[model samples]
Target: MFRFFRWFRDFRRNRNHTLSSSPQPSDKARSPCNQPIVEATPSWKFDSKARWSKEYDLSICHAEDDIIYVENLVSYLELQPHSLRCFLQIRDSVPGGAMSTELCQAVRESHCWILIISPSFLKDPWCWYQMQQALSESPTANGRVIPVRKQLERKDYPQELRFMYGIDVRLDKDNGFLKIKQAILYYLEELCAKDREEQQQRDSENLVDEATPQA
Candidate 1:
């Protein structure tokens, strides 16, 4: 717990330094935007045999304008104890790969998608494309898609995301980030539970088969 706070403090200090030293981009899409924590080695961590196909716990979909904020959020989640693996196109996408293919693959390989819905995101064609890719993966609100509203008006919210309630960071960023982390943790824990149950069921079936006389 203490380590987590220490890391957060360092993170904030570094963030402020970067913001103060970096030059602002001329492109609107690359502009700045404004955007928590759980301390525990969650029970699921003990499940040594559990396996998941997804490469990432979360896939972040955001406009280029919001990279700084998204980067900070990702940095926090990827810290010690949490150690979450997040998929960010800017960081994880294969070099020279087709944009569409990479976007779809990212959506498919991630357990959850976080849509950073800022004004820039709404205007960016690629951001919307990524959102569409994520939507196609579930086609409904099954907790797989997490819409994070930042600097966006209520009226401007997309119709596609209306079904699932989003985390609004326009006012209370800290609370919103906490909720986002909690939501991701909850989903991951649920997956672990389901995996364990399935494994148990399979074990039982195997035992019964072994007990039966050979055909």
Candidate 2:
């Protein structure tokens, strides 16, 4: 009986020792935040041609009478080091019947829309349609629809555009044009900053996932 009791005690001690010495899961393995990680799939291959076609930076909407002024503005924009690509209706000649479709698509694709406001601008049906399309595409505004007033008063402005401030070209041509250029650059900077932040966040998440050990 003495020998049996000693054996039993020894067995119990050995079992307890084994239990205490067993490896515990690491903090990362037991983390509640740990989830099945999924790597982002690339949308296009490295050498895709779609990369070559850049989106237009701006789309200009104006009446036929404002063509000369719009051309001059386009020329000025082209001269800048960070020259913005603009989509002018006259420059992109779609078939007569397809004008509406093309204009809507251009507004949707463009980062910003510049409306040259004048009496003729208000009088034109096509200009009104383009304005509506631009507004619809950019519901949040966010410096998308920039109105360049030409001999038009605040009261004369459309009800929808009245709340927003505009550049009055008639007041001083050079200054107004410079302001427009600066505004375009400002918006571009904002877009680039947003993209960089998003990319950084994505990269951070990817690194965390890659470092985490799987069960």
Candidate 3:
């Protein structure tokens, strides 16, 4: 009995330490344990007995250093095994800025870009560059580009990027966060759909090219 109680206390302390230390944005500090969203939603969206499982999977990137926002978004989505590996423009330990080649590789490798956009983000060259990179690589949902807004308007977006869709996250708060997560999931599903379309298009093109006599 005493032994079990001691073990439980130690286990909880260890978890607290482990979670607090993981390299994340400073917003995490402000995100209280009893955030308003937590009360509105259940303790765990899934089973209390079975381990909770969240379905939204997105390769996220943070633009406005929304670490708490990112954290809460993933939490509500019930991200399992943490599929979304979110990044700020630069990690705290690293001294140098991420270059074009690095950005290219990240955009190419990642399935989606969940950028937190605000007036500040629009002004930053790197964020715009990252958005452009996503546009050049996988322009649609497969290689998706999502802008989660803080207080910016869609109309203000550069004309070149007007066509792309973004996750609407303004004063809506955590519900806004949930909407962003859901949007990512929708895009991921679209990615699966687009894959089939891309394959068929390639097949048709190949047949047409093959059928034509060699020059």
lDDT of each: 0.75, 0.69, 0.54
Return the candidate ranking by TM-score, descending. Answer: 1, 2, 3
Name the better of 1 and 3 by lDDT. Answer: 1
lDDT of 2 at 186: 66
Best candidate, TM-score: 1
Q: Candidate 3: lDDT of 57?
A: 33
Q: Candidate 1, which segments miss by more than 4 Å at Cα?
A: 1-51, 173-175
lDDT of 1: 0.75
lDDT of 3 by residue, 39-81 (tens): 2323223222111122223345555556666666654443322
| Candidate 2: stretches off by over 4 Å | 1-54, 95-97
Tell me each candidate's TM-score. 0.78, 0.73, 0.52
Candidate 2 TM-score versus the reference: 0.73
- Candidate 1 differs from the real structure by a C-alpha RMSD in angstroms, to one decimal, of 10.9
Local error of candidate 2 at residue 34 (angstroms): 60
| Candidate 2 lDDT by residue in tens digits, 1-215 | 64564466446644644553355443213212232112122222211222124356788999988887887777556442344567777655343426887788788778789999999999999999999998888776689889889978778899888777789987773636667866776666666656666767989999999999988
Q: Pick the candidate with the highest lDDT.
A: 1
Error of 2 at 11 (Å): 87
Q: Better model by TM-score, 1 or 2?
A: 1
